[model samples]
Target chain A: MFPTPVEKRSRAAQITYQSLVPLALILWLLPLIAVALFSIRPGVDFANGNYWGVPSSFELFTNYGRVFFESDMPRYLWNSVLITVPTVIGAVALSCMTGFALGIYRFRGNLLIFFMFIAGNFVPFQILMVPVRDLTVDVGLYNTKMGLVLFHIAFQTGFCTLFMRNFIRALPYELIEAARVEGVKEWRIFWYIVLPLMKPAIAALSVLVFTFIWNDYFWAVVLTQGPDAQPVTAGITSFNSQFVAQYHLMSAGSIVAALPPVLMFFLMQRHFIAGLTLGAVK
Target chain B: MTLPTDPPTQTWLQRHRMIITPLMFLLPGVAFFAVYVISPILQSFYISTFEWTGLGSLSEQGEFIGMQNYRELMSDRNFEVSLWNNVKWLVLYLLAIPGGLFIALFLNQTVAGIRVYKSLFFFPFVISQVVVGLVFSWFYLPNVGLLNVVLGWFGSEVNILGNPDLATYGIIAAGLWPQTAYCMILYLTGLNAVDPEQIEAARLDGAKGVRMLWHVILPQLRPATFIAFVVTIIGALRSFDLISVMTNGGPFGSTRVLSFYMFEKALSEYGFRMGYGSAIAVILFLIMLIFISYFLWTMWRDERAARL
Candidate 1:
């Protein structure tokens, strides 16, 4: 509306706009497209300096097969799933109680507690790095999948709490008041009344957290080591170093590491966008 | 006699339950959050005052060397370089806002397959920064890379990432790719909710093109812009993954932003000087605290206003 819609423009202008759309999209995604092309290229293509030309042969199956079989990629993928799934569940579940409390109650320190979560969510990861690592090592959970999962759950709760609290605050408070008047137990009120209404928030938070934890590289590198616990993000970096000039294999591995989150985003695009843009419009 | 009106006892319990219920609900989240987030922040501040290598018994944890690490950071050349590079990153990263707005405006119109186009444009943000770094590294690889090949057509060739002078910029470029996509999505969403009636009113006043956007549309896009600003600032400050994957803060450490530098000092092959690393972390935290305080203040004011 602000820019004057293309539909209201002249016929020639509309045609020009339509033609330019694909051109701009291609230019924007050229790097990713190149990576996708590289992923299917045969290893010999790089050696022969055919980097920019059409692939000498399509080795998509061989390259991807080698990545899955010869490397620890599958293990890394499994680690990502192990780490991400629990993190989503733990963070979401914990935040639900916290969100319900802060959103409904008007007790002293409620605002302070809510602000703590919001502020904590924004602190740079480095500030927590040494101490968190030390804590993990002290607890003997260092270099383990559970260690990463636990840390992620705890940290992600900060953001999830902020999101969930704001969401729950926007819900109809009359229902909660009605339940209270009915003399329902506090926990039962939350369980029966509010939780059902929170389905959308829960869904949004789950998908967002899944993508976030799955794509996490920093904590993965900090708290874990090797295929024993490392998620695919860190594993892919190690894969890069090991493969050296094997761009084809590296490309395939990158694609594999990125697939889950990409799939999640596409499947939950609306919810994902909604989650991200929660505070943007208003 | 036993039923002597247990009213006071029941009232006392009920009164306490009001407080206890909320605390009970808060316990799990608050406990985990305090241990992982709050305690670690305080501990990091404490650790910054000590001298330790992070590789010894708990009793042997380094001696108290109060402010020594911070004093050293004052004169440390790498620290200065990192600080300067961070400034550069912050400045250049702002380009993403306008760049994204332009893209969003271009794609905002309703057209067939526009949804797919928007999704494809946003593809970079969904992937890990590691992949973005790798792709860009390959793109800028001296001769055989796609960028160099494209440049060669115009008879220009440059080793973009390998040169210290251009390495940070190169990495920032890579970072901007995804960041721009993120900003674009935010703007597109913001544009969707813009009031059509106001636009029509503005057009009636002959406010077209730049004047219309400046006086009418820009005012409405404040929330989107604010979010973009906050995210871009944070992203610039926390730039580590791309630098780690692509250059490793290299070309003689010219690209070492504070985040990566802290990681290097604390964890990488440089050997863990936990105290010094904590010192750097403390500095970064203080820098971020400035922005965080402003953001929180604004949000708090908004919350209060909404309540009123």
Candidate 2:
């Protein structure tokens, strides 16, 4: 609206605008396009110096199959699933109650507690790295899926609480007041009254958390080790080192590693964008 | 209401229910959050005063070498390089805001298949940074890369990532690809809510293009711009995944941002100097604290205003 819609402009101007859109998008996504091309490329193509050439043969199945069967990629993918699913559930579940409390009740230190969560969410990970790893190792949870899950759940609670609190605050208070007048217990009121209305928030947080934990490379490397516990993001880097010359295999693995989150984003596109743009607009 | 006199126990319970109920709900979340996030931050500060390999018991094996780690960080060349590199990152990462605004403005119009184009442009941000690094690494490969191939047409083939001086910039360029997309999406959302009446009013007043955008549009886009600035700064500072995937802070460690360098010092094969790593982490934490405080202050003011 600010720029004046192209439809209202002169015919020549509209033509110029239409032509630039695709060109701009193509350039923006060129890196990803190259990777997708490389993923489907035959191994022989890279050896023959056909990096930019049309693939001599489309080996999508073989490449993806090899990534699944011939490497530790399957294990890594399973690890990501194991870590991410529980984190989404745990973080969301915890934040629901915390958010309800902070949003609905006006207790002493309420704002202070809320700000604590917000502040903790933005602290650089390095501050928590050494001690978290130490604590994980000391608890004998290091190099384990549960360790990563616990850490992620706890860390993500900060952001999830911020989101859930704001959302709950925006919900109409009349329902809560009516429930209170009927002498319903607070917990039951939350369960029956607020929780049902929170389905959209829950969905949004679940998808966003799923993508975040799945794509987490730092904590995966720090809190876990090797195929036994490491998620695909970290595993792919190790894969890169092992198959240094096998760009096709590495590229295939990268695509596979990146698939779940991309799928989640596309599948839950609305919720994902809603969750991400939470504070972007007033 | 006093027809039946309540027992003291029941009356007391009823009186304190408000405070007790909220605390009960907050307990589990607060416990986990305190142990994992809050306590560790404090622990890091404590650990920064000691010397340890992080392999053994803290009290029995570690020495309380107060301020030694911080002093060493001052003289350490890698630390200096990482600090300077972080400054460079902070400066350059800001380019994403304007870049994204430009793209958002370009695509803000409704056209045939524009939704698909917008989503495709946003593809980079949804994927893992590891993939971004790998793709860019391949793109910067000296001879066979797309970049070199394009440059070769002009008779130039430069090894961008392999050169120490150019490696950081190359990686930053890769980072910007996704970062700019993120900012663009934020701005697009902001633009969607821009008041059409105000735009019409400005247009009728003979304001157009850059002048109109500068005077009318940017002020409305403040929230989006603020969020963009916050995330970009945080992303620039927490740049470990891409650096780890692309260079491992190599080409003679030219791209060692503080986060990666702390990991290298504390955990990686270089050595297990946990104390030194904590010191580095503390510095990064302090730098980030400044920004975090500003963000929280603004949010608090807004929250108070909303409540009132």
Interface RMSD measured for model 2? 1.9
Q: What is the lDDT, from 0 to 100, of the residue A27 in candidate 2?
A: 80
DockQ metric, candidate 2: 0.72
Collision pairs in model 2: none
Q: Whose DockQ is greatest here?
A: 2
List residue ranges in candidate 2 displaced over 4 A. B1-11
> Could you report the Cα RMSD, in angstroms, for every candidate shown?
2.7, 1.8
Question: Candidate 2 on B93-173: residue-level lDDT in tens?
Answer: 999999999999988988889888888787789899988999899988889888888999999999988899999999999
Q: Please give, as one word, the docking class of candidate 2.
A: medium
Q: RMSD of model 2, in Å?
A: 1.8
Stretches of candidate 1 exceeding 4 Å from the true structure: B1-11, B57-59
Taking chain A of candidate 1, what TM-score results?
0.98
